[model samples]
Target: MTELSAKYGPVFSFKCGQFDVVVINQWKFIKEALANEHLLGRPKETTIPGVIEHASLIEMSGESWKQQRRVALTVLRDVGLGKSEMEDSIRDQIKSFTEVIKSSEGKPITVADKLFLSVSNNISKLVFGQTSAYDDPASLLMAKMMPEAGKMKFFNVQQFMPIIANLVIKLNLFNMTEIISHIRKFESHILDEVNIHKTKNTDDNSIKDYIDGFLHEISKRQNEKDSTFHVNTLQRNAALFYFAGSDTITTTLQWMMFYLVKYPEYQNKIREEIKQTIGLNRQPENVDRKQMPFTMAFIYETLRHSSLVPLNILRRATEDTKVGDFSIPKDSLVTFNFWSVHRDPNLWDNPELFKPERFLNEDKSKAIKPPYLIPFSGGRRVCPGESFAYLQLFLYLVSFLQQFEISAEPGKDIHLESVQNFVTRKKELPNLIFKSVD
Candidate 1:
């Protein structure tokens, strides 16, 4: 798509099966298209089989999307998403993660599983009001399931041609049978959790987690006409929260570790910055980010260079719309090619280089996050967990660097190449050695 954009223009339209997809590569047009109300609708046919049936927050449109988003934001805020309480929970998980690292002393360790468990536990706590043990079967199952689910090709094919894809799904072709079964298992798990939450007697004031808050909303809106609150929606929303919340953060953190080992000098710089700003005696706090400019710059650079989510989720035009003179007919699929923006030479200098100083200011004292760097995306459909993810990334990186020096295993090479997925791009795992700083 970026190659096509180079020859065709920044904004180009192409046919994918029955859908006309408009790919916006430049930031100016992406910003415009995202803000347009007509382009905010998600395509109904693009939804995968056994994945909420177009009813969850990611697929829903208009009034239903608004109501669910509002309720979710409210619930997230009330449940300590951006608060100190959430930070403490994340820190607790980081401590467990460090312990897992320590246990692998003098041996090469693959951080994916342990890291996934730590990140998943945090999301589990937010949704279920409790964290799971690292070795818990359910937690481990999800940790294994998410990356496997990402590897399925069915998700990619469905985006362009849903009718044939649905037929293929019905026929159980393309190894989708296993993926669908796993998705069903996930749905069943969420349903069980929802039922358990329902069994508990709780009121609005007693709302403890996301399920509790959502249930309270459902009860209050039951009297209203055509209310979107119900068991199915709740189940789907919880699944979305759990899957998306954990997978993206875990992938980003893995990339962070990959870069730490690939560029040991920058790792030393970040460690030194951490030592000067936040000594090893105390855990890193969210507020400490303000004082550590280079660390923050490094984080921002990782987000941009990794480009984990190269393209925003496919959005549909509800009506005819114009994005920078390109006419998008009704129901046309529109996507923002963030990969191009992040790597565009016009927008960034030496776009291929992994330079954290690009995000630093003239004096190198403060981090200057340019508007073009939209890893969490932008506009109304921007990631709601942006703040939460940032907090987790900052705290995890700081805490881990404070305790250990990460490097590739002896005779092993670290590769920055990523395996592309339907939604996210995951790094190729490499066994790492974490030498204790103590």
Candidate 2:
């Protein structure tokens, strides 16, 4: 990375090949830009298809962004983050996931769709009052489009015309109708959850979820002279939280299982460790993870090698900032390029290997791992549902490995290629033989 930056940082203004791109890792400048005024929800702009949309806050300058971002972070904290109830629900959801798969009686399965159903359901339970039932029309709609959305940047009317871009976009008649239909459907789902939050039972701590807390916020600022906090923003952020958090983590877990089946040696090591640590019939808990070090390392290696969320977060510079020798212009896009850094040969011994041992330390033949892995990402936009994701991921993988071992089908391709773009997973569904270990 140092070598690449030395040769390319200045040349970035030219060779990076995009108007808003800032190449390489610049943690301080990037973090500053997130909290800065230059792009914190101000003068909006247009983005063509095939890119990640710069955050809504990336347009505001100075004081406005500082104020808005503070509100956003505060709201996230107020909601149930890293709390016990959410993790408990996630653990339950994975158990539900097992029941669903077990009904199929060890048949080869497309576990991604079902696992996403459970994870997304758990997220919805936390964010709103209810979860999406499997086979719901709305669930099917989003599932179809999520991969499409990630493959290419669909139109973003809000970024272009904050006020009436919907009206402006009407000039295009045909495609505009489809876009509007999807947007309304999306908004309607969120609005329904907003309403549920409004009516939550305040009498019980058993309420234990985001909606109850948000309803409290609605009341908190109801009498305040002018409050930036609104039911609308809370609703939007809640929907965004569930969608963003569930997709990437579940996708990575599904792919990890795919690869585990592909490489039986790795799967056996993980299975052996789970058996030795917890034996059979015991559920995996957060504390038990320390006992399953090899299994934990396997998941870590999967996160790195899969590089599912391939791009570092999109940060638009708020003020003129210096990172390395180059000057990053205000309001320009500042990308962290985690893909590059994660794969950097300088930092890793064999940058492309699937070895999980790199993360374990013991005798001379052993390895040591770092704690600052940013798979859930970092900074303000780092996922608030990260704790839930950890529970879902750990329990789902550990449970699946403990009960039934998966293997690629005979005469089928074991080297299943992955789908890629902003984030990714296996293109081919991992239909595998799940022989019961019990």
Candidate 3:
């Protein structure tokens, strides 16, 4: 994609089946497009159970989209999204997380499973008003299938040939059966939770969590023709919250460990920063982030390095829009290639190098976040969970480093290549030996 973008220039359009896709390689073009309300609608997503018209918040657009997003953000904040309540919840998970590592007894251990459970449990609290047990069958299945689900990207052949794409989708020839089944089962689990919330029927004025809050909205707007606050929408959006919030953060924590093991110096540097700022006896808090600039820099660098979701959630033109010199027709699929923007040579010196220092200003007292360093795409449609994700990463990374020293397994290579999926992730996840720092 980088090479092709270089050849065709920053703004280029291509056809996938009957769908027109415009890829924006440069940050400037991406910024312009994201800021335009006319280009904010998400492109059609085919993997979930429902019709594309009833898209989840991540894929929904226009007034309905606006309502869903506003409701979600408001409810999340009301329930301690960026507050101390959220931090306390994460600290509890971190307690269990460290126990899992301690059980390894200083041997090499795979951390993804524990990380998934911890993160999923956090999301579960927000959406279901309760956490899924670590050993719960539904939770385990959902976590196990998420990485595989990421592989179910839009059918490449469908882009250029709409008829064939439709035929293939009809025939299930693209082999979406397994993927769809997993998603259905997961959505069903969420539905079960929503139904439970309905039965409880908590006071309309006092909502328990997102499910209860959504039910209140549903009942309040039952007469509206185009209401997006119904049960099915709740189920789908809950699944989206689980899938998007959990998997991305899980992959990121994995990448953090990978970089810490691969580059021991940065690990030590981050540890020293944590120790100096919060000390080893106490866990780090989100508030401490301001005092630990290097720790924050390391996390930012990891996001830039990994570029998970390389091609961000696809958007479509709600109306004809002009990005740069190119005219994007209404309903055209548009994507901001974050991988290209993050690695653009013009943006960073020696763009390929893993230098957290680049994020630090000359004085090294603060982190300079360039506009191009958009691990999370910007504008109104920016990741709603940005602050929550940042808190999780900050606390988890600091807690992990404070508790143990992680290193690559003896006699094994640490390959940095990533798997090509909906979210580009490390192809090889190393089980590093964890030695207690104390």
Candidate 4:
């Protein structure tokens, strides 16, 4: 994108199928575009299957989007999304996670599998009011299929050529059929959970988790006309919550380990902060973030360095709009190139260098995240899970480092080059060896 931006300027146009997509590269333009209400719609529905209007949060727009997002936000807060309960849940999962690592006995291991169970369980508590054993069939299937979910973006070839894309999906080319089958199975599992929550019928009493709250709403609005809350909607949104909640956090943790292993000095600094602030007797909590600026700085630097979701999902222009000097037609597809914004030389002193101090203030007593350092794209459409994602990243990171040190296995080198898909992840991760801190 940097190369393309250099050649075609910041605002450039490209065609994907029957759609006209305008890519905004610079922070100034990208921010302006995202904030404009006229540019808030998602791309054409045929471009993304299972994302039809009201089908899921990402696919819906206008009233349906607003109602669903509001309900989700309120229920998440009620369930202690950013509070002590959530922290306790994550910390408990962290303990289980560490045991899995201990079972490895410092032997070489691909850590993502063990880590996903921990992360997913944290989300499961919020969504289903329960957690799953790492070896559970459903849990294992989710772990196996979650990474492939990223390919949905890669398979969005329908955006450029509907006929060919339809044929590709129909013919099972590129495992499209198999992928959809897995997605359906995943959705079925979510529906089963939703059904269980429905049977409990906690509506007349108190809402328990996200699914419980959703079911309560579905029961209340079952007869209402044009109601966005329903069984199918609940199922799809539940699946979305699982997908968004688990995959991103899991990938960020994976990157956190990769960087920590590559630069042991930063890991030492983080450990020192944890020792000075929380010490070893107690588990790390979300509240400790303020006392450990350096640790937060490291996490922030990783967010910027990785730019996990490189392009912040596709958006569509609701009406004809003018961004800078360029004119964007109504219904035009739009996307922000976060990778460019994070790497722009004009935005940072040395954009390519991995220096956490860059996020710290002059005296290093406070962490300063620049407005332009937008790992989560800004505006009304900004990630609703921003706070939750932050809490998870900090607590999980501190908890892991407090107990052990992560390093590449013997004879294996850590690779930093990322595979660009739905989420930016290391092309290949060496089996990490965990050494107990004590």
Candidate 5:
């Protein structure tokens, strides 16, 4: 797409089976298109076989999308999404995560698995009101399942040719059987959690977690016509929260570690900033970010370089829409090529290079994140967990660097190339040695 964008201009459309898929390569067009109300729809559930039968927050359109997004934001805030309480929760998880690293005792160990579980536990605390033990069966299963799930192309032939895709699903071909089976198992797990939440005495005043808040909403709206709150939506949305909140953050953290080891100078620079701003005696706090510009810049640089969600969740045109001069017909699939934007030479100097200084100001006293960097994306359909993701990334990176020096394992080659999936990009990370800074 990035190569094609140069020849065809930033906004280009191509036919994919029965649909005209539009790709916006530049941030200007992406911003305009995403902010437009007519382009906010998601592909129909029938077109995506393995997705929840009923659309979750990511797939819902129009009023249902608005309602679910509103409720989700509210519930997230209620559960301390941006509050100090949430920071405390993440810090607690960070402590556990650091212990796992510390116990490695300078041995070469792959941290992705532990990182996945630690990140999952953080989300588990918000959605379930409790953290899962690293050895917990359910947590381990989910940590194992998430990466596989991320690799699946939920919008493949299914989006372009629904008839053939449906036939393939019915015949259990192309691994559709296993895909659907895994999705069903995931749904069943969420349903079990929902059922457990139902047993609790939930009310508006007694809301403790996402489940509590959602259950209360269901009860309040049971009598309303066309109500969107129900067991199916709650189950799917809960799963969405866990998946969205965990996988991407874990991948980003993995990239952070990879980069830190790859560029030890920057890692040492970040540690120095942590030492100066946060000190060695205490854990890094959210407020300290303002004073630690280089550290924040490094985090932003990793996000831009990784382009984790390269082509963000595909959006559909609910009505005929004009993205700049291009006319998008209703039902057309519109996606922004974030990879192109992040790597666009016009917007970034030496776009291919990984330099945290690009995000710093003249005196290096402040970090300047340009409007073009849309790692979490933008507009109404933007990631709901953006704030939460940032908090976790900042806390995890700062805390991890403060206590340990990360480097590649002995006699091992470090591979920084990303394995591009249909949705998110992942690193085939090498095992690294972590020596305690103390």
Candidate 6:
């Protein structure tokens, strides 16, 4: 960090290929970046091409971001995040995923695709109060929507280079207008959900999904003229759930199975513990996790090895700031070096090695440590879906591992080089064989 800081300076600028860019590292510097008024300041509908737009999501910088973040936090709590009710929804998705595996009849399944589908379905249900039973049209539509959505580049070229942007726009190079159309289609689906939730008398019944919680808040704050509360906000949030929920959990699951395949000895160790603790014929639950420490350790190792956001998303600096003699100017784009943190050699013994024991103990006295575990990133912008993510990952992993014996197919490997797009996704879908032990 010191080396990079010296070269970049606190507020110095650098060029990327043809575009100028700003980099920030210090925690305080980054926080200042996210508070910049002009950074996310455009009217929600007049947003730059290809980004998710929520009307009330205008760039407020300081107090606005803080207030909005608090509202989001409260909404998560009110909607039962980190509670048993959310766990039940997760378990239901796990059951759905298990059924998909069961129908495979000992064939290799696409681990990435199946997990993505399942995780997306689970979160969609929570966010929209609409459920998808795996291959439903809604699920299929979203699966199709995501990849294309990722390919659209609105903020990159335009935000980075305003001069070339005018040229790009004139030549009809990248269609900002089309991305909005795609967003319109996406919002259409969310509105369908919002309309259904309203018709269902779910408010009175307190159905307790994200949409329910958001709408309730909207009603509470309706009379407040300055509030950003609205039905469209609910729609955008519903769509955002699909964005936030699906990919990270899917990536983590892929790495989990990848390590298990590469290290059968560790796999056997986890299985042995699972058997000794709960045995077969019993459904896996969150409570079972505490008894299987080694199993949890393997999960952590996978997260370490699979640095999901290699470059991570950019945060804009709000003010001219100093970080150890460097001055990062206000409104400058900031890249959190989460990737560098994860792969820091000073933090790990042999950082490149696939060692689950690094998070557990080969010797009980000198316990293994997690050097840099930023799978979900951290701070104000840290993922809001983490509780649901852990629940989905836990239920699916426990249920699948306990019920099946997964093995790497002959000459095939589950590689971890998934290209990072809007959200990082597998370069190719992961295919793994499942042999039922049930």
Model 5 per-residue lDDT tens digits across residues 153-248 = 634776677657768788876677777777788788888888878876633358889988998999899999999899888988888888888888
The C-alpha stretches of model 4 lying farther than 4 A from their native spots are 50-54, 152-155, 163-165, 202-204
Task: Point out where model 5 deviates above 4 Å.
Answer: 202-205
Predictions in order: lDDT: 0.84, 0.62, 0.82, 0.83, 0.84, 0.64
Query: In model 1, where is the ten-residue run with the lowest total lDDT?
Result: 45-54
Candidate 6 lDDT for residue 250 = 74
Tell me how far the alpha carbon of residue 339 in candidate 2 is from the true structure, in angstroms, after superposition.
0.6
Model 1 lDDT at residue 409 = 84
Which of the numbered candidates is closest to the native, going by highest lDDT? 1
Kindly report which residue pairs in candidate 3 clash with one another: 16-159, 16-160, 17-159, 17-160, 17-161
- Given candidate 3, what's the lDDT at residue 105? 68
Q: Which ten residues in a row have the lowest lDDT in candidate 3?
A: 45-54
Supply candidate 1's per-residue lDDT for 20: 82
- TM-score of model 3 vs. true structure: 0.95
Cα deviation of 59 in candidate 6 (Å)?
7.2
What ranges in model 2 sit over 4 Å off?
1-11, 14-18, 25-80, 154-179, 199-208, 222-226, 364-368, 379-381
lDDT winner, 3 or 5: 5
In every candidate, how many clashes are there?
Answer: 0, 15, 5, 4, 0, 9
Q: Given candidate 6, what's the lDDT at residue 141?
A: 67
lDDT of 2 at 74: 57
Q: What ranges in model 6 sit over 4 Å off?
A: 1-20, 24-60, 150-155, 158-181, 201-207, 362-371
Model 4 error, position 38 (Å): 0.9
lDDT of 6 at 38: 35
Q: Write the per-residue lDDT of candidate 4 for residues 6-114, one digit (tens) a residue.
A: 9999999887777788889999998788779988788657334432233588777777888899999899889878888778778889888888888887788898877
The global Cα lDDT (0 to 1) of model 2 is: 0.62
Estimate the overall C-alpha local distance difference test score of candidate 3.
0.82
RMSD vs true structure, all candidates: 1.7, 4.8, 1.9, 1.8, 1.8, 4.3
TM value for model 2? 0.81
Per-residue lDDT tens digits for candidate 3, residues 218-309, read: 98899999787887788878888888889989989999889888899998999899778889879788889899989989998999988887
